[model samples]
Target chain A: MSTATIALLGQPNSGKSTLFNALTGLKQHVGNWPGKTVEKKEGSFARNGVTYDVADLPGSYSMSANSDEEVITRDFITSGKADVVCILADSSQLERSLFMLADYAGIDAPCFLVLNMEDVAKDQGKTVDVALLEKKLGIPVMMFSATDTKAYDQFYFTLERALKEKSHINVSELEKEYEKIIGYNEIKEQIKGGNISGYTPMWLTVKYLENDKVVSAKLKESLPADAASKIESIGLDANGAIATGECKFKWIDELLEGAVNKTKTGVKLGKLDRIYTHRFWGKPAVVLTVILGLLGSFIPALPIMAVASIFDVLKNVIGDALVSVGCPAFVTGLVCDVVIQSFSYIVKMLGFVFGVTLVFGMLEEVGVMARISYVFDNTMGKLGLQGKSVMPFLVSFGCTMGGAAGARVIDNWGQKVLTIALAWAVPCGAAWAIIPMLSTVFFGAGAPLIIVVLLLVMILHMWITAKIFGRTLVKTEDRCGMIMELPPYHKPKWGALFRYVFGRTKDTFFRVVKVVLIVCLIFYILSYGSGVNDTSILYKVGTAIEPVTKIFGLPWQLFIAFVASSVGKEGAVGVISALYAGGSYGEGFMAAMSGAARAANLNELLLANVSRPEALAFIFAITFNLPCVVALAATYQEIHSVKWTAKIAIYYTVGALILACLAYHVGLMIW
Target chain B: MKKLLELLKDGNSRTPEELARELETTRDDVLRQMDFLEHAGVIRKVPFMNESNGCSTCASCSGCEGGCAAECKGCVPQNAKMNMGTMWEVV
Candidate 1:
């Protein structure tokens, strides 16, 4: 029997093993390659009275020295042990899988191409013309299904033809592609007639352009000293690899253009994606979606808001019962005013938290949030920040502390600080809850308009703040654009979405309840006094600051609430509940209230004491205030610069007060 | 591929589909080019906080190194959304 050795080469999962096993079966022996852990398998089988010895080489992504397997595989191919080489390409995804064939084009060894997984290709509705690919490649090419035993006959026939014909890949077309790359001709000319074995000069030049360390080192060692110096003087460009890679891809595309047919060739965006990706309309479309989403959140929150009001009614009824039962005033106030009232506000905030988390979380689940982020990415650059700054801004809407932490991804220190600086301007979840509640209390049915205006002001505020900070923080640099692989829109898993929403709501409820209760109890105790006395510590302190606070259109009581907001925005609601309801601060204003209104709820009491303009100013102040002390610590933690952190904190504090002053003046003109 | 890089230099973010349309090629082809460019160190994937996947320990360093401080869950949240799209940019 006559024996011919054949080596199998392919990327992992290209059916190299299946083909090896089908041909060799029980005749195979496996062992480790010398000085490496990569597996080596060799076997022999007799077909049609001829014996074939097969060596299954270690699979690698390409013939590069990135890994030991690649080096071992390439070395074995050129070691001259195999008379013929079998190169496998996955027919199902020829665009990607043919990379091995492309890389192997310039090798001097005789080889044949096996378009494996022909069955899989057919199932995917792909029709590949084997004869056309063979003619283009100038080698024996066969459609193959390695998993089918019956296909061995054709595989043997092709192997026999390859060994008999000693066919090598047609490199003329490939070399033409390489010639388009700058410096290719110079490198090729210098390496021509050089002593580097097992590779053509064109192959060595292409690998050198790709910065292939193995190839470059070999050429440098083998070439004459003068010739090596001349090649080095040409100087490799940084983009050489990118250029050569592009050329190889173009060559592959050309080779497959007429050889493969498929129904879908390119990515197609869905309808919503088209609108969200539109150059002129994308920003507007994303903004409108957010507005609608926020509005939609309110619908689900209304039921929870209604449930929270029951706690308010229960507070009044139980307060009357405690008074009738001879309970101490402090005890009654602690139970009804501090505990129940705080719980009521917390529950109401939880309503909005649930709504916001659910709506936004759903958007994320369905992939619209990614488009929103992409839309805002370029806008980040206009602010002298990278596209990634949008993430911190988005996280800020949920929690400013979280936003500050998210800015850690920004490697540039200036941009990191600036990103956190702007993130503070986004009103957090607690502010979101209080703003709409207060707006509803003051503006009634016009709450949505207030939300819209606040959203608009947020944009204006960020733009202005970016201008003020961008000069000092971020320097001018070439801002590279980003490529986003937008996730395809899909139906949200309602179970997971609701679970997350409820989890977030429960977390917010517990956290807010604790802060609100403690803050409310402290303020309520401080404000405890006889009717209209103003002798209580809170009243005395508030009155002392009323003049300064008045400039911002905040009453002493509202100013105290604003200050407490710097602790935690939920504390603002606590201070408001305690000062407005548990004390006699509203006594003088109550005289102007109708007899029926006197017996009205805490919202009515607040409306009686706080004018619309003052309410607007206070709302603006707390919304824009330095988010919370926790956020302050978080900013310091992230930036690790005390001066910058303090700078950002002071900036937000001063900016919030200024915003409040402007809103107050604006409110004075409007109302 | 050079055209793709040039398009990114305009400082506008584009999805792969949009890039494919502008490049007048299939998205798979664009992706292949991106893969090569990225491997060649000409571009990189933009890292995000959620990419941490709630791993409080830094894989790239030892002993915190000012990342994922013990008191802060900000860098990695247990429940951060995982469905955000991928983004890449030139290095």
Candidate 2:
């Protein structure tokens, strides 16, 4: 059997994942490695009649163990399992990649040097002598693209021959280097760990030198106290030893010196990149983007209003058809109020979602978002964040799903989590989707005032929450730093925007729609089935929640709606719609809010609770509450902790309660 | 601590053992509180540790041109002090 259990390792954007996917196809998943939550992926394919188990370790610059991911990569390399490691490098960014490869080379393990993205290197008009590099490094070198199958096939043949004969590589010329490495395998596991686990080697050593308590604790559990203390004493303060390893990035320099010779010169963004990365500019740039993004948000919100109005017309036409069909009164009411209301709400939610997606998609599809990142690099620094990493924070406002999805762009763990948690505080489109509905329904006369107040409260709440959270959740020393490559501005591609929006929206819609529909249907059945005087479930539930609702000037039934809102905020809106269609929102709010107008056969607007100022509080509260079950699942999945997910729920619940209460009063004051 | 930091920042070179001796502590003790020093890139290891064991109690050939540069290969004494280079600073 050909030993093709190739493990790809390198720094970020070295095209490792791309090559892995290309070699094994997209049929894979990010699973755990042994026991840790760090993403582990495995894919298998048979080549030359041998089963090949390919592992795609997390991308990292060195195995020095600064981060958990680095540790994992280091461990995998040091772990005897990998038959042949295909260390991929971006030929353009060889210095850093090769620096990491140096430690691997220090071990002289079986490896294949794959220089990926050859096309990009060529496009840049650079020539690398593959044979010369292979000769110099004393290892097999393969130049190919994961995007191109033809290149992979040629590379595959070379890999096949090398795998059949391990240690065929002769490093006799580098006699001293080889001798230093030959018997050093015994010391591999002696390296402890850092902020994460004990598995990754490079990070462990760095963390050890840095004297990171977390890393040291793990190491102390395994090694002697005297030894640990001695190691801790030698390096610069603590992390100095780790930093030294990275500082001595001579291997990276050598790799660049060996493989790359630039043919053309473009205006590199050295000054521009640095200018934006300044501390003063970082915060202000972020402020401007937020203001501009918010202001422009209205421009993009137009199509949603049109689409929502279209749904309104469609519902009206359906209502007219129902009247013509001479359906029973209850049947007509149920169809119009319950089903129609939910469908229209869905359309409204989709409209706003698609609209926002259109704006962001256009910005990202053409790769100009990096310009926006550049403009605020300095501002990001002032905020103690890596500039241009604000998308994850902003997207959480639209939906935490988007927030989590967008966080994939950020590489730093500390920054990614903080950005995610902070953005979850932002009010989503679903929250604002409550506005038009409220404006049309209850406060038919002063609808505009109520809508304005609700919108104001959402913004104010986000600002306050952001202020408090940004100050607290982030650590004191994590002074934001920006080191981003500003991509060149390009013409916005319409088709790409459409595809980006559709792909995201479709995935999101499918994930959330079923829960919403089921909640809506369940609420409809409960309110209608139980609300016959004192016998109906609605009447019973209202009575049960009456005291609790009274504290917030709401009826008892709203408690049930509030509980379901945790599943998805729209579910709360859906339940309200169901209640109104069941002749309960108007009846129940009056029953709950102390003599609310008693009206029979309410308009679609009235049945939807679209206009009540307090409905604004309820909507926004639900918006900010424990994220929908999907989000809860996501939070649990991403963080890999059920307890943390529950803690997040507790946090949001308290935040929602306080914010909603304040919103209810402030909306009253403003309106 | 302040003087050494300033000197390092100003690009002064001092061996870890000398600094430890000056501080009147073990080499490990001086190295233990090296937080800001490391962050600021003040203290570093000599490039190669090949002769580190040999010179721990003997004459340091690192600073002299007599060995690689000092042109004196093996006549250095065991009790002589060490001379370090930044290359061996954990790299």
Candidate 3:
């Protein structure tokens, strides 16, 4: 009995490991390659009294020296250690998987092809003519599933035959394909018959054209200096690896021209995708979908919002009871105004949070969100950024600070700064919570219209902001096209979607409660002066600023809340709960004393007190305000430019106020 | 493959379907060429997040505040924008 060393080679995920394990089960040893961390596997199997030693080469994309694994695989092949190389390619995608075989063509080694995953190819309506492929390649070709146990009989027969008659892949067709490249023949002639042990001149020339560092170094060392310099000039004109890669792919296509046949299936977009991906209709389709999605969220939110009103009724009952018991006014206000009012608002905010998270999460889970990005990718380009910049903007819908962090993917600093700058205009999660809740309060059944208007305004604001900032931050020359692989739409996993929504809503509940309670407490203190006309310091300051605040259509109280929103959007709600409900403290006290009806619910109180125009203005103001101080810090961290961060903050502030003024005037005209 | 690179030189992003349509080929062909192009260093995949540095930078970062260091659910991953798809750009 003699020993035959057989090496198995393939690209990553070509079922190489499955075949190796099938042949060497329980007899294999795994260790790292010499001086490298890449795993090496060696095993033996005795068949027909001949013991075969098998080396499983590390899987890589190609035989190029692009990585440690590729170098090791090529070195082992060229070292003449293997009697025959069994190259594997995925039959289901021979156009791609055969790339390894194509790259291996010019080597002076005995090899045969194994087209694995034949069952998968058959299921896909493909058939590979093995006899034709074998004749074309001058090698033994087998198409079989490595997972099939009985397939090893044919594999053994092929291996024995491959060993008995040493065969090299027919390179006549491949060399013809390479001859078309501008520099291939010139470089091949310069290095012809050069004293390289394993690589033919054709192989060395292709590697030199590819700028493969190791091969280039070796070739330069072997060839005379004059010949090497001449070869270098010719290789410089080639497109390096891309040109050679084209050659390999083209050659593979030709090799499979007759040997591989498949039923043609043209790519077709789904019905909904047809509308979503339409060039002219895509943006409007996406915009309409988002608007409808926002409206759809309110259905779930309405119930939770109604339940939150219970907290309002509880506020009144607790206050009346505390007052009846002769509780101190300070304790009464703390319990009824700060604590109850803040809890009510936080509960209401959670409803919107849950609704938005569910709607958006479902959209993501079902795959519409990707279409949204596809729709906006061109718009991103117009904004002086790449298509990838749309990702951070989409993230901004959940959190502006996160959007800033997502900007890390953009390699160009100017585009990154501009992306973060534009992302700020998109209202974040907190804004989404507060704005829609406020819209429902002010607009009633027409709240969805307010959301639509806001979305439109948001688009306009981002466009103008990009124009204002893009001049200095991003240059047109820095832009480039991108290739997007849109994922196919599929049924969403309901379990995961609800888990995320419940998780996000629960998170918002805690975060909102903390901010709202703190802001409410502070405002309650500032406005707690014991006077008939509500003449506390906050009252005084608010009245004094009333005229200036009216320009933005915000009352003094709402103006102060707008100011607090810069701290966090949730803080704005706290201010509203304190100021308005604290006014209830005085008004409710007067009503209780006179035996008139106690002040109505907080909703009615707000409706009677703040004009519809003022409410609209306040909503726009807070929605478009600087997201929060944390977001401000995140912006600076991402752009690393205090000057630019401050610039963006100021821009959003002024932009919000302008948008508010416009919305207020529009509201006044409507009413 | 070179034609695909030529199409991208216009600085306008396109989907694989669009590229296939423009190149007058099947989507699989376009994808296979893209794989080759990407490996050859002609194009690169655009990552949406730098997982290593994203959370490490901000200590009080609200996005990662609630022990979601491994995956920030609050601030990022708000939706399926990540599921939107894979993107590659010319290098």
- lDDT by residue (A1-671, candidate 2, tens digit) is 75457787877788888777877776667788776778898888777688888899897755555567876876676666788777777765454345555545544357778777888878878778788787777777877776787886788786775676563234333323322332222222344322232234443554444444555676767666655565544433443443444333433444446567767453344443344334466445544544444435446555655565554556556666766677554565556666665666666556545655566545544443454544543344444444324555444555665455445444455555555555566555455444444444455445445544544554465456445555644543454222222344456666655665566556446644665567767776676643344556676768887776655534455556777877777677676666655544444543431212222233443545433546656655676676566666655555565655576677788877776677667657866
**DockQ of each model vs. true complex:** 0.48, 0.01, 0.59
The TM-scores, chain A only, for the candidates as listed are 0.86, 0.54, 0.97
Alpha-carbon runs more than 4 Å astray in model 2: A1-304, A307-326, A366-420, A427-474, A478-482, A508-513, A529-535, A543-547, A550-560, A585-604, A607-612, A637-644, B1-91
Candidate 1's residue-wise lDDT over A1-671, tens digit each?
A: 78899999998899999999988989999999999999989998998788989999998877767788989998888778889999998999887778788888887789999999999999988999889988998999999999988998898899999999999899888899898877889888989958666777888898888888888888889898888898899888777776777777778888998899887745566789878878899999999999999898888988988998998789777877776788776687678778887788777777888888789888988999999998888889889888888888887887888788788778789989889999999988888878887887788778778788888889898989889988998974746788888887888889878876776777677778888888888888788765454778778888898999999999998999999999999899999988887754655533422122234677777887799889999989998899999889878888899998888888888888888899999999998
Best by lDDT: 3
Cα lDDT tens digits, model 3, A628-655, are: 9988998898889999999999988998
Candidate 2 chain A: 10-residue stretch with minimal lDDT: A592-601
DockQ value for model 2: 0.01
**Could you list the chain B TM-scores for each candidate?**
0.72, 0.33, 0.71
Best candidate, TM-score: 3
Better candidate number, 2 or 3, judged by DockQ? 3
Estimate every model's Cα lDDT from 0 to 1: 0.82, 0.54, 0.85
